[model samples]
Target: MSTPYEVEHGVTAGQTGRRPQNRRVDMESFFSFLHQISTDAISSVSSETTPQTHNNRHAEATPVDTANLFRLLQDQFATLRQTSPDATNRDFLEALIQEVDRDIADLPRLHGVGQEFLDGLDRVSKKEILKGKKGEEKCPICAVKFNEDPHPLVVALPCHTSHCFDLECVAPWLQSKGTCPMCRKNFVRKKEEKKELKEDSEEEEEFDNMNGVWLATGYPQTVIAIRGVDEKGLALVRNGVEVL
Candidate 1:
């Protein structure tokens, strides 16, 4: 006699039934952390030893060649009134490095926004990538043949090309990886973690049932999470297993 509203509100199932609103904040925190690490490595500024004038080094072609970039950017922001006032702040900051730029400004526009640098990067990357398109590989999941195209099923190891696996299959394995089998890359997510949490929460709720009797959530949630586990593991712990 469980009401639909009760099911919707997670009075019965806690974790799996959660909506996007309940998950957005957590997802954002995860991705923001990802963005910070990626940007830092991509945008690092470096100093190089001057071949000549070793004693009085000039910043000619250093990663953050401030003088060169500034002169170029001034022409870019010439239409803006605010750039002149805070020009000093520009000295300390260098150009933000970007990855995989794909936009190209048309030449007939008769202006320079420096988008060309990224477009050139894109072109170079495209050429280099095209040069490497000679081989064919088959997807592990769908068995589709691909030439210079990613196997939708494959997950490529960052360090090596021989380390690809079915992406869908690999993700679940990675959630519990805690470490890569080959490279010892550590990752951990017990698929059963949230189930355990839900089970614990359900047990708490059952204790609070207070009406001299309580009904089992028949959670099936936990059991489903651990379905592929060993037979002995299920023998003693089947009560919480969702029979579905």
Candidate 2:
């Protein structure tokens, strides 16, 4: 008959069965060994791949324009400071906001001139534009044939040669430039004429200062003297009064 310990542990009567204390210790050691192997493998993989991944990320990174970025940051910070007065960094924020505001105020302001210039241009019909053409006239703005286009809105400029443009095309352009696209003539005729007259007066003043007093001699008389005095020192006389 088999002993109780032998039957329970599946050991022979002469062979000893493993103690419970030793069995627990062996199981702990086996688990510890497995955990250590797993840790070592993970460490090895990380050490091998980490440098290469970091190098790739560094190589692919793009450089930023720091000056522009700093300016943008300063503007945003100034705006924030304006909105929140009780926040920190009061002095620096005030200075930055003041500088931005000064720059904005220094820019030239255009008022009612743009709208008035656009309104002054003559709006003409497509039939008037193509009055003498044999169905071959094209709009200078859209580059489309007048016969083919359904819309009939066209604007004629007051240029010496009378250049016409499509209303839709020239309206937006006039708001900003206020000039004819083809001839580059100013839409505000009176303003342009005044400017030219002022420039001419300035030039005449400069010329009068450089030369002696021929102030009373008109432009026609001056031109005649210039032509007649081809080889002599011609003195201009206004009403028989000789000017040196």
Question: How far out, in Å, is residue 234 in model 2?
Answer: 40
lDDT of 2 at 242: 59
lDDT of 1: 0.28
Per-residue alpha-carbon lDDT of candidate 2 for residues 1-244, written as tens digits (9 for 90 to 100): 2322233234443454222221111122222222232221111112122211122222211112222222332444344454443433345446544543443444422111233454456766657545646225544534444445333455567774346654434443343234565565665566878989999999987655544433434566543122122245655555555544
**Residue 23 CA error for candidate 2 (Å)?**
90
Best by lDDT: 2
Model 1 C-alpha lDDT per residue in residues 1-244, reported as the tens digit of each score: 2212232233432433322221111122222222232221111111221111222233122322322332333322232222322433232121111100111111111111111121121111223233444224432222222233321223454434554433322222222222232454432233246668999999898645533342344665533232332445422224454443
Listed per model in order, the count of residue pairs whose N, CA or C atoms clash below 3 Å is: 5, 0
Best by TM-score: 2
C-alpha local distance difference test of each model? 0.28, 0.40
TM-score of 1: 0.19
TM-score per candidate: 0.19, 0.31
